[model samples]
Target: MGRLEIKSYEKIKEFLSEEHVGRIASIDENGYPQIIPMNFAFVNDSIYMHSYTRGEKLDNILRNPKTGFEVDRELEFLPSYFSHPTDASQADTLYISVVIKGKAVIVEDDDEKTLALNGLMKKYQPEGNYIPIKNNDLVLDEVAVIKIVPESIKGKYKIGQHLRTDSRLVLAKKILKRNSPTSRQTLKVMGFEETPDGLKMVDEPVW
Candidate 1:
């Protein structure tokens, strides 16, 4: 019934690893937030991303090292009608997210740069069709690898975990009938399983 925190480091890492992209925020010269969607790899307790040697985001990071990074998945949207027909205030959404407050630096060391680039490749191209990055690779000169060292990491998720059993059962049935792309997975995370009889709460909530 309280705010559920994802206390499992493994689960947090797994979520970050599987997420396709994350948004990084930096303070611009004018003190406005500049947020960019980036392809990144979570490795060594840090976030690594590659960019052009020159860019607004890179410039912002260089000027102001404090940064924020976030990754989230919107699983399902519960209609207001699920709880109330016309009140329209009972709607809720299910989601999982990780937020980070960190310091960013442009990696200058070739060895660490190589490792970060290779880590990015392993995440984006897991099929193993390309060569591993090397310290002396020519492309390293053209690309800038930004490494974010997190000062704080917070993970949170909501998937009907706070509802009473009767309320949750009703919600699960509605979600199943809605049958959105993520409905089944959402139900599973909420600990529901389909059975010959009907929907059953067979396990504890995963997130």
Candidate 2:
């Protein structure tokens, strides 16, 4: 909940890779928030997303590059622990979230665009057959690519950071032993490890 107190930026970076599909929030003409689910590549400590030739998100970024993105994972029911009426405090909910704020700049040069697209492919296509990205494929004179230069990046992992060592061990065991969707992800979810590469989280790097 508070400002990020996690280990290192590498941890945050890994988390971003773990959670590749984040929502990009841009400001509409009337100052409303426009969020679109996007597959992003975390490289060089920055995030990049591709876009079609035209759209509202592109317009908003062109008008104002400042934007915010968020991705989160909740692991509350790892044990299905429900608070008893005798307990006064609320039940526990373990979770983690990442927030990034930045100014987006559309890649202007064709070479840069191609490189960005390749980076994106490498991120998602670690195992898929290689398909060279040509400027003609997507990046044309009209198509737009947004490189999100993060002004600020943060991660809040509320998975009992304050819990005593014993409680943490208990949680870890639960994560390791359980078989549900959230629990099965404990190793990667708890920062103990990362999901393997070649995971298809995005189509291409647009920016």
Best by lDDT: 1
Candidate 1 lDDT, 1-207, residue by residue in tens: 245688788989999999989999999999999999999999999999999999999999989999999999998999999888897888889889999999999999999999999998898889999989899989899899999999999999888777788888999999999999999998988889999999999987655
Evaluated at residue 144, the lDDT of candidate 2 is 65
Q: All candidates: CA RMSD in angstroms?
A: 1.5, 8.0
Model 2 whole-model lDDT (C-alpha atoms) = 0.70
Residue 56 of model 2: what lDDT? Answer: 93
Show where candidate 1 strays beyond 4 Å.
Answer: none
Q: Write model 2 residue lDDT over 142-195, tens digit each, in one string.
A: 556678888988777765456555565556655555556665454444444323
Q: Mind sharing the TM-score for model 1?
A: 0.94
The models' CA-based lDDT, in order, is 0.92, 0.70
TM-score of each: 0.94, 0.77
